[model samples]
Target: MLDNNLDTIINKTYIIDKTPLNEEKIKKVIISLKDSIISSKEEITAANAIDIKNHNGNIIDFSIIERIFKNINNEKIYYGNVTTLKKDNNKYYGKQYFDKGNVLIFNTGNPYIILEIFLKNFLAGNTSIIVTTNYAYGLNKLLETIIKTVLETNNLSPDFINLLTTDAPEELLKNNYANIDLVIALGNKSFQNKITNYSKVPVLLSGYETFDLYIDEMLDKTFLTKIINLHLPMHVYINKNLKIDLRGSMLVDGVEEAIMQINYNGNGYSSAIFTSNDDNAANFISKVKSKIVTVNTSPTIERLMDIQVKDLVLEKTVIYPNKKKN
Candidate 1:
C-alpha cells in the first residue's frame, strides 16, 4: 500500500526559496540522482527489460530497448530546457525559480522519461509522487527501490520521492482535492480531457497537442529524403504505444493533401519544417496546429523540451524523444 501520510506530506510542500543554501541542497540532490542513475544503469536497463517482457501487447524491439537506456542518461536531467534557478524577481526585476507545487506523475509516455521530470521538480523543491499504473510491476518497483536507496543514502526524506503501484492509478489521479498540485499526463485526447476536468490543478498535457511536417514546396528530393529518413525512427523509438508516428508524414503534394494525410495519420506531438526559406518555417509555425514546431531539425521530444519548459511541454514525452538506431 502507498504511504498513509500522503496527504500530510503533500500539504507541507508549497514554499520554495532561492537562497544559496537551499539551492545547494537541491543541487546536491540532483547530482546524487544523476550519479545514482549512472551507477545503477545496468540494473536500470535490466528492470526495463522486465517491463518490456511483460508488456507483450506493445511491440518491443531491441533497438527500442537500447534507445530507452540511452535516453535515461544523466545529462538530460541537468541540461536541455529545464532551468533550476530563475533570476530574482523582486530586486533584479527578473524571474525567480521555485517549485511549481506538489506533483503527480502517472501513465505518461515511457517510464524512464520521468527521470527528467522528477529531477526538475526535485530541483525546484517540490515533492513528486510517481504512480505506476497498468501493473507492469518490474520497472516501476525497481526504479522506486533505486530512488529510495539514493534518497536514504543522502539523508533526504523518503517524502521527496514517493511511488504507488496499482492496477488503476486513474482512480487516484482523477481526485483533484487529493493534494496533487500539478499533473503532467500523456494519454489520448479523451483521457487528457478527463484529467483536465477532474483536476482543479494545472496540467502540462500532451496527446491533444498535435504535430505535422510543413515542407517547403521548393525543397529538393534529396534533402526531403534525408529529412524523412531522419524522422522515420521517431515512430518506433518514442513510445509507439503513445503514437509519436515518426513514420507517419503528410507528403506535400498540396495543402489539402497535407491536411488530409495528417488528419488520417500524424500523432501531432512533435512537428517539423524542412525549409531553407525562413518565411516558410514561420508560416508553418503560425498555421500548423502543433505545440512544437522545429525548423531544420528532426522532431524529437528532447528538442521539443529544449524549446519549452516541462509542463509547458509534456511531450516528446515520458518515453521521451529518441530514435532507435540499428
Candidate 2:
C-alpha cells in the first residue's frame, strides 16, 4: 500500500513540473544521466540481479537498457522547435511542448520501458511521474534512486521525475480534477483496462504485447538451439508476465497457425520469422498486425522502445503567443 497522501504528492509535483524548461538544461540532464549509467553499471546490474533473483531467476533484458542509452543520443535530442510556418496576417502562436508540461506513466514490468519514457519526457521538457509496476517494485525503486542521484548531481530537482509504489491507481483516478496532461501505460490487458477505465486524460496504451518466432520448416535441434539461445530471450521480455512465466505464449509453426493462435488466443507486440526464402519472410512480416515487423532478427527490447522525442510533443503541443513590437 502507498501513503495516504497520494493527492498531496501529486498536487505538489504538478506545480514543480510546470517550471519552464530549456534545451540547454535538458541536454545537461541527459548528459548527466548517461554519465551516471556509465559510472553506475555495477550498481544497476546488481540491482537488476536482485530483482531477477527474487522473481525466480528471470533474466533482466539488457537489450532494453542499451536502447535507453541509444535513445538519449537520438538526433532530435537537441531539437527545440517544430518549424511550423506562420500564417500570413493573423498573429502567429507557437509553443513548444517540451518547454513546459507534465506526463504521467503507468509502467509495465520492464524497468527499461520506464527509463525510456523518463528520457522521452525529459528531452521533451515535461516532468514525468511513473507509477511503478507492482510486480517489479524493488527494481523500479532502484531506478527511482538512480534517477534521483543523477538529478541531484546535475543540480536538477528530484521532483522532475517522480515514482509511486502503490498499485492503487483507482484512488488518484477517482479525483476528476487531478492535474495531469498526458497518460502513457505499458502492461497486460488488465493493466491497460484499469488505466482506461479511470484515466480521463489522453491515454497512450501499449497494450498486452508478446512476440513470436516462426520457422519455414521444422529445423534441426542444433539450429533451433542456436536461435533460441540468441533470440528466445527477446520473447521472454515481450511476454506480459515477464520472462519467467509466459515466454512462449505464442510460438507457432506456420503463418496460418500463428494467425489462428492470436485470433483464438491473443496478440503479440512483434513477430519475427527466420527463413531461407525471402518471399516467405516477407509474407509473414506482412500478415502480422504487431506494431513492429522484423525478419530474421531478434525482436529486441531496444528495437521495441525506439521512438522519437517528438512523439510526446505531437500528443500535446504548447501554443506560444509572442507579442509583436508595439
Candidate 3:
C-alpha cells in the first residue's frame, strides 16, 4: 500500500549525524536510554518471549549485559587502568611510543573486546595508533578517550593521535597499505570482496554480525511492522517469506530506526535487518520467528542471501523468512 521509493525511505532517516552531547548531556542520554530500555522489558517479554541462553546452553533469565549496564554505576563501569608511556622510539622499534594502558571493552555479544585487547597490545609498542570499524560513532568516542588519556598523562599536543575514514576495505588498504603494521577488520563477507587477493597488512576478520538479543527482543513488534511496510511499498507481501532487493541500505535505516524507537521509548520502530536471500532469512527466522515476502526472483535471492544475512546480523537482528511465494 505504500508508494514511496527506496530512496525516500533511506533519505528520510538520519544515519550518522545525531547531535553531539557534552559529558552532562551524555549522562542524560545514557539515563534516558537506560530508562527506555528498562520500561520496554515488560512489553518485550510479552511480545516475542523466548528463553535466554548462554554459551553453556543453560537457560538464563536475562542477558548478562542487562545486569552490567542496568544496575552498575557509570563511574564503576568506566573504571580501568591508566598506562603512562615515556616517549621512547627505541623501545618500540624506532616508533615513538606514547602511553600503554588497558581499557575495558564492553561485551555486545561479540569478539570486538578480544580484538580491541589484541590491537591495544599490538599497538602499545608503536608511536601511533589507528582504529577502523564500521562503527564510526563508537570509533570516534574511543579515539577521543585515547587522545584525552594520552594528552593528560604525557602533557603533549592534542593532535598526537590521527583519525581517518574510508568507505570500503579497498580504500583502507589503498590509503594505509604498507604503512599499517596491524589492521583489525570487523564484519565478515562484505569486506571479502574488498579484502580478497590483497597483499595488505595483517587483517583480523571477526564474525560478520553481532546480535544484541536484548534489543532484538525489545524491537520485535516494530521489526515485524517495518519489514512489512518496507516490502509493501514494492507491492511485496513478506509474511514468512524472503525478499531481495539491491536497496539493502534502505532497509538498514528502517532497522536502526526500529531499534532507536524501542531503545529511546519513541514511537519509531527500526532495525538493521535486510538480506538478498532465503538461507539468511531462514537463519534469522529460526532465531526470531519472523517472515518476509519479496517480489524478487528466487535465484537472485539465493545468490546474495548469505552475505546479506551476515551483514544484517552484524548490526543486530536475526534473518527471517527466506523466499516469497507467488
Prediction RMSDs, each to the true structure: 12.2, 5.6, 20.9
Q: Model 2: how far is 34 from its true place, Å?
A: 1.2
Backbone clash pairs in model 3 (N, Cα, C under 3 Å; residues 3+ apart or in different chains), count: 24
> Order the candidates by TM-score, highest first — what do you get?
2, 1, 3
Write model 2 residue lDDT over 233-290, tens digit each, in one string.
Answer: 2342122222223345444445666555533433345656555667766776777666
lDDT string, candidate 1, 217-289, tens digits: 4345576566555422232122122233334532344444444444445455676655576665666566656
Top model number, lDDT: 2
Cα-based lDDT for every prediction: 0.51, 0.61, 0.30
Q: Candidate 1 — what's its lDDT?
A: 0.51
Evaluated at residue 228, the lDDT of candidate 1 is 57
Candidate 3 residue 207 Cα shift, in angstroms, is: 3.6
Candidate 1 or 3, higher lDDT?
1
Model 1 TM: 0.59
Candidate 3 global CA lDDT score: 0.30
lDDT of 2: 0.61
lDDT, candidate 3, at 101: 24
